[model samples]
Target: MKHNALAIALTLLLSALLGLALWWDYRRNATPHPTPGPASFPIDTRSAARPAPAPTQALPHNGLYRCDGPAGTSYQSHPCTPGSRQGDVSGGTLSTVTVPPPRPLPPPVASVETPTPKVGLIARGPRPGEGNEALCAMHERDIKRIDEAARRGQSSESQEWLREQRRWHKDEMWRLACGR
Candidate 1:
């Protein structure tokens, strides 16, 4: 009993030491973050170099002026330079492609004869010896869904519970004598 107590005490001490070592290692290796304070705030280096913002007032939408400058002809929304000659801008028409309307669909043909059911509920389920393909397919789908749920990692159920559910599904497949 004393030996068991001593072993337990040693295990607890080792666990505590390991935890402390891990915590210390994490703290030492972790990136240092600057504390939020007035002195620690970042300076705007571009504040002086930055250009003043344009006026928010809307410009007049008067007709565009075509200016023939000394260098080349240029288009401007406002009056050009003092020596440059300006003209009233005109016609640059864009031709649009016209799409023809779609043709109407053909009417569905009506069936005169009534359809007869071949298999019932008992026929769909598993028989004495031979297994049902539909049930086996459904089981496979359920197993895949369970695996997907496990991978998503957002389930309210524990991993153990999910594993149990998977096992249960596999057991059900065996009980149903599927894939025979």
Candidate 2:
């Protein structure tokens, strides 16, 4: 009764305050920020971008090692075993390999056959043709059969039939309007 009304009022007031806070936050973020000062820019970004080179350690070394064991063949950075052959890895880092820039595509070929425009005022819809009245009556009978088939649980077939009906309706309207 009265308590319910008071609870609803408090809830509405809380909602309004929350909405006001969101509006204030949106406005604060939406306002354009001042541009950074020149002093804020990094002095030597190129040097900073380059990573420190890895330290070299002395060891029994071979650039690449390939081992042909009784099980199978394997290749790694370790020194080759007594029975296996050693070889260098091609392209140092395979991931860093670059592709040549792509050639520019040729312009589209123009269409040779251009249709000539019809002369005088154009008809708003399909032009009237002979025997269209009989065709429209046949379409109406087909539509009634389709509706019955739809009631028998053939939904997909009925939907396709309905599309055909709409097409026929358009043709019928055009035929009746132009008296053909």
Candidate 3:
């Protein structure tokens, strides 16, 4: 009986020592110095700094289409118009001829001369009085001369004369119409 009591006391003492040692180890590990703050973990800031790529806009008829048939045959369709099939009907090999895509047209060149305004075959505006009739007649004659010069390809002389006639007519018409 005495031997059993001594053995139990030694066992209890050993268990208490083991428990105290385990508690000390846990406390040492749990209580941290220079406690964790915001920048504790090594964060890869580059990933956050990198901008996400812009989403691609899909054009018309861009997705894949599929078709199935008898005899355990299945086929994928391409971007084609209605009733146009990429594969053969009889399961034969298809001959593909890839046409070179059309090149974009260059932008139109800007011309120095203004385009003539076309208002069908009708008198442009109200006719001037008898006193200004000669000015009107002169304006018409100048226009005819300009047209003839342009038709004959006398561009420089025609442009110069046309500019002079335009300025003269504009000034005269404004004066006659407004009684200035």
Candidate 4:
């Protein structure tokens, strides 16, 4: 009973000390924001007054005219005078070219037949001692080669597929009773 009471007293004292320390830290770091008072300068009056600008006259037509004079070629706001020879100003003459039709494509070549990959026996093993020793040894060698390829980061097959092949080889060895 005495130990329990002492523990409770120490816990309460530690909590109170923590609360006081947090409150002191908060008070020390906090900044007080003063309430805003009235501003010093006047903001209602307009300082300098400006006058309205004058309007401009509109043109009759916006097209530009070209005129060849004695002082070289000159551009004017008016057209070339009557009975006078005028140069072509609406872009120079255009030349046209005849394009030949594309030749028809040749017929596709016949596709060649691809040879199929060789597959091993699945689920079942060869007869024990019936020329299966060589087969089991081949499987063991395949497992070792696949493992070495994986260790050297040169494996062509996926990790999961390689693991499945290894399991198949182990199963084949067990079923053939290779070393037994």
Give me candidate 3's TM-score against the actual structure: 0.22
Q: Write the per-residue lDDT of candidate 3 for residues 62-161, one digit (tens) a residue.
A: 2333333234434444433334333323424645568999999999999796555657854365445536766766766776776666567556866787
Clashing residue pairs in candidate 4 (N, C-alpha, C atoms within 3 angstroms)? none
Q: For each predicted model, how many residue pairs clash, with residues at least 3 apart or on different chains?
A: 0, 0, 0, 0
lDDT of 4 by residue, 85-168 (tens): 334355444344579999999999999966555456333545565778788889889999878756765445677677788889
Please give, for residues 23-128, the per-residue lDDT of candidate 1 as tens digits.
Answer: 9999988968767656756867889698544334333335456677688998766766767666545557434467999999989888796555548633354464
After superposition on all CA atoms, what RMSD does each candidate show versus the true structure?
A: 26.8, 25.1, 30.4, 26.9
- Provide TM-scores for the models: 0.27, 0.21, 0.22, 0.26
In model 3, state the lDDT of residue 110: 92
Error of 3 at 156 (Å): 3.0
Q: List the residue pairs that clash in candidate 1.
A: none
Count clashing pairs, candidate 3: 0
The TM-score between candidate 2 and the true structure equals 0.21
Maximum-TM-score candidate:
1
Residues 15-127, candidate 2: write the lDDT tens digits.
99999999999999999887764556556867878854322332333444444555567766666565644433433442334699999999999989655565565535446
Name every residue pair that clashes in candidate 2: none
43: Cα error in model 4, Å:
99
* Per-residue lDDT of 57 in model 2: 34
Q: Between candidates 2 and 3, name the one with more favorable lDDT.
A: 2
Candidates 3 and 4 compared by lDDT, better number: 4
Error of 1 at 176 (Å): 1.3
Candidate 4 or 2, higher TM-score: 4
